[model samples]
Target: MKSELRDLYQEVVIDHSKNPRNFRKPEGANRSAEGINPLCGDEITVHLKLAGDVIQDIGFQGAGCAISKASASMMTAALKNKTKAEAESLFERVHSMLTEGPKSSVNPEELGKLAALSGVWEFPVRVKCASLAWHTLRSALAGSGAPVSTE
Candidate 1:
């Protein structure tokens, strides 16, 4: 059963990486962020169209390993239609799960298919790969002048 779960996770990761949804910027995007993993040269640019507190549309463009690309793809899908506050909360939840450790507080199902990335914690070197886009999103939302750095 564990092996089956692992296989399923791998498939999810691959599918998203290969055919990412919302992979192009929307016209006249009001907000944007660029994220890069210097180690592997993974680069992502996230574009957002906001309607007040709600995220009306979201998209991205990037090249990266399966993990980084897939995470960004899933993130764009998950955050669309979400309020700014909700997006922040979701980001915090996923960030804690990846950087800290999984805990009962995290709803496993709420991660949707992104739970596939749980394996990333075991591969310490790839943690940044998984988090690059997330940090970028946070910086974009916060309007921070500092570069997004998860490490």
Candidate 2:
């Protein structure tokens, strides 16, 4: 069952990487930010439309590895319609799950599809790949309009 679950998650990652969701600029996004991982040359732009404290819409565009692209795609899908606070909480949780090592106690189920990326911890280097989009999303939410770099 564990292997089956791994296979399922791998398929999810590959599917999203090949055919990303919300992978375009929205009609009128109020927040936008870009993130780059220089080591692997992965780049991502996060676009968000917030209505008051609620995120009405979110999307992304960029060139990256399967892990990065899939992470961005899944993140957008999970965060749409969430309030600013909710999204931030998710960011903290997902960031922890990604960076913390396999010994982490973070419950992936709490993150929804974002949990598919839990396996990323296994590949220490790829942890950044899975987090680029998330960091970009946080920057966009900050309304900095500044480019983010994973250094």
Candidate 3:
């Protein structure tokens, strides 16, 4: 990442972490799942209202590290009105980015604000923090009752 882009991404991460979007349990949310990262004590619940496979609305409620919260916030924003397949594809992309570090094939520019998390791959432990919400979102979309855990 270029110096300026890194700085900008950092700023985006900080801003989202400080004031996460969709940080609530939205009304009429028909699907929900909980996630936890016991290593870092990050916990969250993702909620979604699907209208025939399209995400009609999305929200989350939780207390966690900046990365976790921001990821959830950005995820909700990115996923609203998207189909389940789209969300899952996005998750795969983001998951790859998180695990692959800067060498990941996915383009940061393509992720929009979510590209801010590009740097997180450098920190191994923080990856779990950042991914907790995403895994939970998958669980919610799958309508799974089991709680998610990053162990």
Identify the leading candidate in terms of lDDT: 3
Model 1: residues with Cα > 4 Å off, grouped in runs: 1-9, 145-147
Task: Choose 1 or 3, whichever is better by TM-score.
Answer: 3
TM-score of each: 0.87, 0.92, 0.93
Writing each residue's lDDT as its tens digit, candidate 3 over 87-145 gives 99999999998889778999988998898888888778788988999999999989977
Which 10 successive residues of model 3 have the least lDDT summed?
A: 3-12
> Which residue pairs show collisions in model 1?
none
> Any residue pairs clashing in model 2, and if so which?
none
Q: Is candidate 2 or candidate 3 better by TM-score?
A: 3
Provide the lDDT at 55 for model 3: 98
- Candidate 2 to truth, TM: 0.92
Q: lDDT of all the models against the reference?
A: 0.79, 0.87, 0.88
For candidate 2, write residues 31-89 as lDDT tens digits.
89999999988889999998999999999988999889999999999988999999999
Candidate 3, residue 128: Cα displacement in angstroms equals 0.4
Supply candidate 1's per-residue lDDT for 108.
51
**Candidate 1 lDDT, 27-130, residue by residue in tens:** 86788877777777778887888888888898989788888888888888889899999999988888776665555377656788777777676567777987
Ranking by TM-score: 3, 2, 1
For candidate 2, which ten residues in a row score worst on lDDT?
1-10
